[model samples]
Target chain A: MSQDTLFDKVWDLHKVSSLPGGSDQIFIGLHLIHEVTSPQAFGALKDKNLKVKFPERTVATVDHIVPTDNQSRPFKDNLAEQMIETLEKNCLEHKIRFFNIGSGNQGIVHVVAPELGLTQPGMSIACGDSHTSTHGAFGSIAFGIGTSQVRDVLATQTIAMNKLKVRQIWCDNKLSNGVYAKDLVLHIISKLGVKAGVGFAYEFSGPAIDELSMEERMTICNMSIEGGARCGYINPDEKTFSYIKNKLCAPKNEHWDKALTWWKSLKSNENSIYDDVIKLDASKVEPTVTWGITPGQSISINQQIPLLDDLAPNDKLVAKEAYEYMSFKPGQLIKDTPIDVCFIGSCTNGRISDLRVAAKVLKDKKVSKNVKAFVVPGSEKVATEAKQEGIDQIFKDSGFQWREPGCSMCLAMNSDKLIGNQVSASSSNRNFKGRQGSPSGRTLLMSPAMVAAAAINGKVSDVREFIN
Target chain B: MRSKFTPPIGKISNINGQCISLIGNDIDTDRIIPARFLKCVNFDSLGEYVFEDDRKTLKGKHPFDLEENKNSSILVVNSNFGCGSSREHAPQALIRWGIKAILGESFADIFYSNCIAIGIPCFTLPKNSIEEIQKYCHNQFLFLEIDLKKSLAKSKYLNFNLEIKESSRKMFLSGEWDATATLLANTSLVEKKFKELPYIQFCNDN
Candidate 1:
């Protein structure tokens, strides 16, 4: 059992009671609901004749199925319009606050919460989306829950769950230039196989973690689910405190001082024990990209795809499946591979900083005519910030489409989808087969800058070449 | 596709069904139900669309599509099954497709809980044992009688011990797997914790 770690502290703080089934009933400080998963949960609530217990604690947003191309009401897709309308009705009936499309707070739930200062240290956050772990970057105990559990949280502000074991992923050195947090996290997932985190909460620590900005930390924690961990966190520090200061929902004046004092004391003790410990040097990480279906089937930009013989016995099956599904040879180099679409968005890498980085790479250059490239900001605020900073103009000048927010093409819940077996260089988290809509479509997960590079070259090229 | 779907209810101590083996590792939720199918407001129509893409690719070769596996209710799969996405629709689709229980080498955390939440009891076996069962089912139908209390799955010629989290097993035995009621039982404690939290006192949002 992990002792005195930040995860332990936050978990113990929120634990309501031990249930008869040996699971702890943990209180959810923040419950985030989006259109896709929450409608059914709300329906269940209605069926059971229960109202949201702590309506103030739960937040609603429309994502997942929202069309990024059009922001107008009565969406082109009737099913999507119906889903969003259902959510609106539920939130109104339950008296819960909602961030509607034009609210400036509407975007991916993970991005909206942090920007609005709803995410904080020492809290327990739950959302219907797996990327809810993104809020854990603030030193909170956050994890994704299924719809049934979402109903439980809505009715009781608590859900039955087993405490996850904490694993300290200690990175020795900071990432090199051109190697962003996306590369570092992809490297971590590749190193720690996807299943390594099934029962663990990863605590990202040491010099490399501390060196990352709050947004970068969010990026790292956002992909924890891809690594099979429901929760991943960084201990609260000056960066976290400063980032939370003056935000919409942050505490004010004396309250802010009290919150800071409490946040400062939220880190793990010097001698805190972890269930498991793994150390790596982040400086060694390169701009990594996924070549296969699962995120773990990745390689550094310069490396060739691994042969089946090079894999562990346990990994051989999936590697074989990936090789066939992706239509790649065993020793084929991932670099210079053709890409038909270049997407830069999703909860993974759709923030303002991500847009700026991509825009910087795209400046004074034109996207390859063979590729269709676009950038979707994570939220409405992110879109506004990009426009004000001229980042959107830069992307448009480079022949990349500047689109509205909402999870566009990440899961392809809307019209933005990969046509047929077209390959895409995506900044989204998953590279699962058909994840980007078409049953045969392929996704190559990379950093936003890397996606820009691919867009410029019409193929997978090393981002460092551009940065250098 | 089949009859109207009836959800599992009450204490689930025994599950008797034929095994339908799905051979794969890290078979994700996206592959199970696909994102395009999630546009609806409910999971009622999700059953027919389960494994829609994979089934299309397999052209009736997928276990779920095979004539022999049509009525099988015990899904046997390999390690790290249901790896991505927290969508309960994956398990909901599977249960609606006639899966009553699952035996796998391991399951993803959120997917496992989702399975238990919707009353699908997921059990585990050793890698070798799961492979053997899958291999046996590939050639011929394997009927299994699973006793939750003993954590044992018995067939005509073979019997294997299953592994399940004690808490999950207890939840199944006691009908606490429908966790909303169980969680609501401690309403006072939930309210007390709310008041006791330090951030609740200091952080008042507008």
Candidate 2:
């Protein structure tokens, strides 16, 4: 068991009691609900005739099923409109704070919370969505839950869970120029393998982690689920405190100082022991991309897809399936592979900083005519910030569509979907078969700058080339 | 898909059913029940669309679509089953399609908890044993009688010990896997922790 790590500290602080089943009943400091997952949970509560125990602590938002092209009232898809309506009704009945569309606070739940200063260090957060781990960037103990657990949290403000062991991923060196946090995380997942994090909560640390911006840290923690860890976090630091200082829900002047003092003390002790430790050199990480269905199947932009003979015996089955599904030959270069679509959005890479980097790459460039490229901000706030900075205009000038914010084609619950077997260079997290809509559609996961570069070239190209 | 769907209830100590083997590693939630089918207020209709895309691609050749596996109530698979997304609909869809228990080499964290939360007991076996069972199912049907107390799965031809988290096994045997009631039992402690948490005091806004 891990001791004295940040995860242990936060978990111990929130534990309510030990249940008869050997799982701890931990109070949820924050519960985030969304359109896609909460409706069913609310129905379950109604079925059980239970009321929400701590309605004030839970927050609601609409995403996953919202259309990016239109923000109007009734959605074209009746089922989506019904789902959102169900969420609206549930939130209203439960008296929870909801950031509805056009509220200026609406976006992806993960993006909206941190920007609104709702996510904080030393907190235990739970949500119905898997990317809830994204909030762990602030040093909180956050993880995703299924609908039944969602009901448990709603009814009792606590959940029965087995504590996760902590693993320290120590990155020794700073990333080189043109390499982003997305690349670093993808590299980490590829190195650790997806299932390596099953019973562990990854604590990303060392100089490379400290050097990343708040949004970059969020990007790293956002894909922790893809790496198979239900939760991943970075220790709170000056960057974290500064980022949360003046947001909508951040503490007031006197309270801010108190929060900061507590946050500073939230880090792991100098000699804190972790359940496991792995070290890597971030300076050696390149702009990486996923070539297979799972996020673990990745390589540097310039590298070729691995051959079956080179794979470990355990990995051969999935690798063969990936090869067939992706239509890629063994040893074929991932670069210069043609793409039909280019997408830049999702909780993973749909922040203002991601937009700025992509806009810089697309300043005087034009998207290839053969490709349909679009940029959906992670939230409405990100869209507003990008417009104020003229990033939207730059993308428009480059023939890329700048649209409203939501999780657009990332999971394809909305109308934005890949048609037929079209291939997409996506800034989103998952590249699972049919994850982007069409059963045969393919997704190539990359950083926003890489997606922008691919949009300009109509194929997978290294973002460093554009940077140089 | 297989009679009217009925959910599992209290004290699930024994599960005797036909085993349906799915051969793959890292079989994710998205593939189990695609994102397109999630736009609903309930999971009642999810059974018809479980593995919709994969089933469509396989053209009735999928194990779920096979005549012999139609009534299989236990799922057998390889490593890292249910690896992506925290969607409970995946397991709901499986249970609705007649899966009452699962045997795998390994399972993702959230998905395993989700299965346990919804009354599906997921057990594990060694890689070689799982592979042997999967191979055995390829030629003929394998019916397993699983005893949660002993953590054992037995068939006429073979017997092996199963592995499950002790806490999860306890939850299943005691019917505490429906965790809301168990968690609610600690209401006073929950309120005390809420009051004691430093962030709750300092962060001000709820």
lDDT of 2 by residue, A213-239 (tens): 999999999999988899999999999
Give the TM-score of candidate 1 (chain A): 0.99
Full-model lDDT for every candidate: 0.93, 0.93
lDDT of 1 at B205: 60
lDDT for B67 in candidate 2 is 96
Give the per-residue lDDT digits (tens) of candidate 1, residues B160-202: 9999999999999998789988888899999999999988887
Q: Interface RMSD for candidate number 2?
A: 1.2
| Global CA lDDT computed for model 2 | 0.93
Expressed as tens digits, the lDDT of each residue in A1-68 for candidate 1 is 99999999999999888876567989999999999999899889989999889999999898888888
